[model samples]
Target chain A: MRVALADDGALFRDGLVMLLEAAGHEVVGCTADGDTLVELLATEPADVAVLDIRMPPEPDGGLSTAERLRADHPELGLLFLSHYAETHYLIRVLNIGTQAIGYRLKEKVGSVEVLSDTLTRIRDGEIVIEPVLAQRLVDRPSSNRRDMLATLSDRELDVLRLMSEGRSNAGIASLLFVAAKSIEKHISSIFMKLGLPSDAAEQHRRVLAVLTFLRSVQDSG
Target chain B: MTLDTYDATGSARRRADEHWSRRRDLERQLHDGPALRIAALTLRLGLLAQKARHDVGGLPHDIEELQYQLHLIQQELRAVADRIYPPLLHEAGLGPALRELASSASVRVDAGGGRFDPAVEGVVYFVIVGVLAALPPATRTVDVVIRRDADGLALDLGDVDTGQIGAVRDRVRWVDGVAEVGDGLIGTIRVRIPCE
Candidate 1:
């Protein structure tokens, strides 16, 4: 997949480039600022845009950029990367009704295989979210929420709850006392049972789901 | 024809009044626009020149970090240079250069130093000449001592007017160095340059 990776941190940007390229994915463009990222997207089309939620010029919300891109170019697959696992951001992305949109925590970017798989899934029309963020929604103790969890297995629910808190697979493994390999299997099952799209870009759906769940919780509170 | 001649005077008076009003407008513009611009430009240029002197004048000390003592010496040098042989000191080397400064001021200077780098010699020379120029017209004499030790070069500037000691000390502190004011109102500025 041709990917456009945008992040303000110089070290992280370079690392992502190396990781993506090593995974046999061609990175079309990389930028340190939101304005430059928008410009790059116009000139260079990519299969998916992997963007940081907070970029230069303003360190806070990247919702404006995301909103602009969704309005102008609906076909462009968008993935928002963030350090924080706030659920409101996920709701905003999903509300756009874009099938390939994704949200992934930055910490989960350690392995190239997982990152490439996620990117590929998003390009294939999947709505991906990180596993830990998904677990937060499943774990929320509410009659209305329990109905949502009824379709997902107990293991999938567990993963979703952890995913909500922005924990990576390694983090979930340690918490569950299960092997990291088992965590991956459980995450796949969660996606399968949730009727979530399993496009290669599904990693973003995990983040989006958790973000949406968090927003719902905040709104209710 | 007689009526027309009478009206000519009235017409001439109105024309004159219009001319005077136009002249006043031009004068106001000159006062508020170009003249103010020129003044602002002059102040900016003056600050630039002062900053340039502060930077370029200390080139010879070659010390990594300029101490307060060295800065004071440079400030005094600028004040003195502004008064006498200003451009020459910047253009020429220090030995005969400072002599020119002292001679112009009618001050007696006894200066001797072994072969030193041009920069070190320039700073020492400027400080000596500067302190002499700073002295009040009533004060008759000033002394300058320059020495090279194992640690670095030390310049002892003595006999600066007591009243200016505070000003001199403040200037020295600006450069991250020290100054000592003695009981005799002797303003001693000691600048030590580490041997490179």
Candidate 2:
């Protein structure tokens, strides 16, 4: 596959480009911003274009560019990489009039095989979603407000509902009458079920999950 | 007759003195309120402008991702300007201004029949942008819910990413507001700003 990589992060974009090239994919162009990516696409068309969801201008600026590309250049396969599993981006990806699209969390590119497989799938006309994101689609609770409480496991769901209400570990501990340490253990378990790593970015991922769940519920309603 | 005349004259002088004091007090309040408001507005705008400039320079340079971040900054700046002085709020009202701000993100906004006093709208706008500006690099989408009820204006900002919830909370608190961060992979921020 001839790939064009776009990401404002030099380190990340460089690493990804190297990975793709090592996997036998040809990288035709590299850009630090979306405008450059657009220009590259217009002039030097590639079979696939991999982009970071957020980049220069600001961290949240790349989504519109992605939409524009999907509209203008339907033949080019689109893939989005981000630090977070943003549902908004996912929905946008799903709405794009092509099936050759993919969204993956940056951390999930831990192996060359996974990245190459995703690129190939996108190039072959499959909507590739990261495993973590796929889990979200399966685990999303039903939107029936009455059944919403029942859709989650007692512990895993409690953590999620509190999370949606914007409670911290300490806050949840106080609310649930448990130790903060115990709350931490429950959260780790939740992360495992959700296919997310429990690390410094865990809280951010949890927020992303809750937002996805909420948005799904909102959409269903 | 002489005694009656003296009492009437004394009473009249006392009433005149009381009326003069009341007038002076009212005049002081009238001058103070607007002067203080103007000073506060000026200071707030200055601080916001400085912060905006700092944020622009601090923007990351992952060129592939530049367009996304650039769009976010543009949306934020517009929100900041509308907040500082809502030409829209003054003309079309709160709903129109918020709708305009929300349109930039391509996200659906449900305002819930909330109305903003012009001043409240200004504060809400700045607070929203300031919180957004403070967001760490990982956050993707920001869901802003501005509600005006018995407690004034409450802003519920839910970020699509939560990695920097602690930093976001600290920054929000520094602005003299309360931030509630939910535990999960994604983060939601609930800020309550009193109308007063």
Candidate 3:
């Protein structure tokens, strides 16, 4: 598979090139910024374009690249790597009118084999979502959304509902007279069932989950 | 004077004063504390990761992964720093800062260029950010151009709704700037504040 890579961070970009090359994929194009990525994709023959969601010069370099790539090369596979599970960015990604795209967390690229597999899968016309963003889709208002949230038990729902109110885990624990560890467990379960990631970007993940929970209720209201 | 008149004037003054104090506190905390600490930590990690990668016979997978994770951590911290106080607004100036804000949102912001007071630049930087932020992501395009007015610096924010300018109006007013937000297909938020 031929892949093009774009990221402003030279270290990360070099690591990505090594990963792709080690996996036996051709790194036909390399660029440090977004506009160049779009340009490279246009001229270089590549099955997939992997982009960092944020880059320099443009506040949303990755996003602008996505827009240009989708518009200019509709058939080209796009795989966006982001630092956070930013739902707003996700929404914009989806709105670009292509289903065969991949949005994955940057840190999760640690699994090079999985990364290569995802790129191939995306090239084959599947929309690959990072677990966190997948959960957000499940939390949106719909029958499927309700069924997904129903996977959480009554206690879990109570925890999530309180979380949607912007209470910290410790605060919620105090309110419910439960141990902080137990609240953490429940929140973990909430994330697990909703498809959010379990990692160091805890604040971003928590906000994404709560935003989904809030949207579900707001829509029902 | 009536008690109601006294209360209204007093309350207005109090609210503005409180906002100024809160902004100062937030700015001081960000500038003097967390932002520097985060930048230092990021630098330390980068150095460590670089050493770890070379200190080993070859590029160790664990150290490489550590490098990747540190990069993410560093980016998030910088984002937090920008949210608290935009670094570009200070280091580069308003035009670059506004451009950063526009590019981040994937919206086009064409800002007029001129060096101004730091406070004026900060106010304009955030007001444009606030206005763009309040608009639905559905809003695809916005134009911001500055002008040298006879009285003050003039900012014309085109492609905005009157409602979208509420946040901008409040911030502009804080610096004793005049704001005119109106409704149209090209709803505009025009502001002019004297340089302090």
Candidate 4:
């Protein structure tokens, strides 16, 4: 797969290039920060773009860049890497679309094997979130929200959990050993029980379910 | 003024919390983004070193030195990140954040409270941190109380040194709250912030 990366640190970016190239993936493009990354996409296209959430100096460097990339090239994949396990960022990126996106903590991305696997997953149209992120979302205080989340049947909740992790309908089906159509039915029921607007986009509704169940309790602070 | 004597509704309190929340959010972003990149780099370097050691011949001297340098960089970066904003500040609230601050301070400190508005909590944390940072090395035994009240929340820090009160007063003023600072070495500071 052709992969492009953007990070302000020269050493880290150089290491990533070596790591990706060593793993036999084509390093189609590289840029120092998100703005150049967006520009790189116009001419030197690649299958996916690995972005650092906060580039040097600018606090939220990659956020708008990814938003623009998603808007401009719907088929292009995105995988976000950051140091902290903050869910608000995850929600914003997931709301972009469930297709071809991945997020992992910088510290947790251990080896070329893991990064390559994630890229391959995204390339195959899966949402990839690091497990720590899922744990953080679960740990977020949901004092008033427990009942609503508890309404999901165990099997339904399993489907919602995988959906939140960026799994496709077919992917969830295979994981649960169910049919894709039943997974769709489970999702429709999840949405119906949550009282989401019927006309909302399917992707938006999926994100909404995840966001509702594991909404960042820290949004207040 | 006693907590109940003054009117407690003020727009600045809301605005202050918004500002502080944004500040904390920015700090967290730095912690998660750049801080983690260095960590990932360290891991990758370790992986490379492990490969050079086992799969290949003995580890290359150059790889060994590079690994040591990266380890130092990661540690220094982590320290810088923690000082920029301790994760406890956002996670555990003002009481824990302050305790973390006072961990190394020369003076003895006591602090506790119920949760309040994030902005109110932030002001309390930062003000106390600033105050403790300026306390005389000879100073000892400060007391702090933070609790929710009918109107909003009250924070009182006693036995404060006079020199640091200016910064504390400025922060209180920004929030449209009042800070009562005593005149002598054994001074007291009390603040009542509206819940707005």
Best TM-score goes to which candidate?
4
RMSD of each: 30.4, 19.9, 15.1, 12.2
For candidate 4, the per-residue lDDT at A21 reads 77
lDDT: worst 10-residue window of model 4 chain A: A212-221
Q: What is the lDDT of residue B181 in candidate 1?
A: 56
lDDT per residue for candidate 3 within B65-99, as digits (tens), equals 56466556645765676676565554446665664
Error of 3 at A81 (Å): 1.5
lDDT of 4 by residue, A1-221 (tens): 89988987676677777777767789989988888888888888789999887774265677778888999888899998766455556666777766798887665554566677889889888778877566445433333444566676878777877877777799889999988999999999999877788899887788777776554233212
Q: Write the per-residue lDDT of candidate 2 for residues A2-68, one digit (tens) a residue.
A: 9997786665666666666656789999998888888888888788888876565443446667777
Each candidate structure's TM-score, on Cα atoms with residue i matched to residue i, is 0.39, 0.43, 0.44, 0.57
lDDT of candidate 1 at residue A144, scale 0 to 100: 29
Report the TM-score of the second chain of model 1 against its true counterpart.
0.41
Give me the displacement of residue B20 in model 2, in angstroms: 47
Worst 10 residues of 2 chain B by lDDT: B35-44
- Chain A superposition TM-score per model: 0.68, 0.65, 0.64, 0.78
Instruction: Return whichever of 1 and 3 wins on lDDT.
Output: 3
Q: Pick the candidate with the highest lDDT.
A: 4
What's the CA error at residue A144 for candidate 4, in Å? 2.8
Across B95-161, the per-residue lDDT of candidate 1 in tens digits comes to 3344444323433333444544433444445456556767765354454555667865655666566
CAPRI quality of model 4: incorrect
The parts of candidate 1 lying over 4 Å away from their true place are A57-61, A141-219, B1-196
* C-alpha-based local distance difference test score of model 1: 0.56
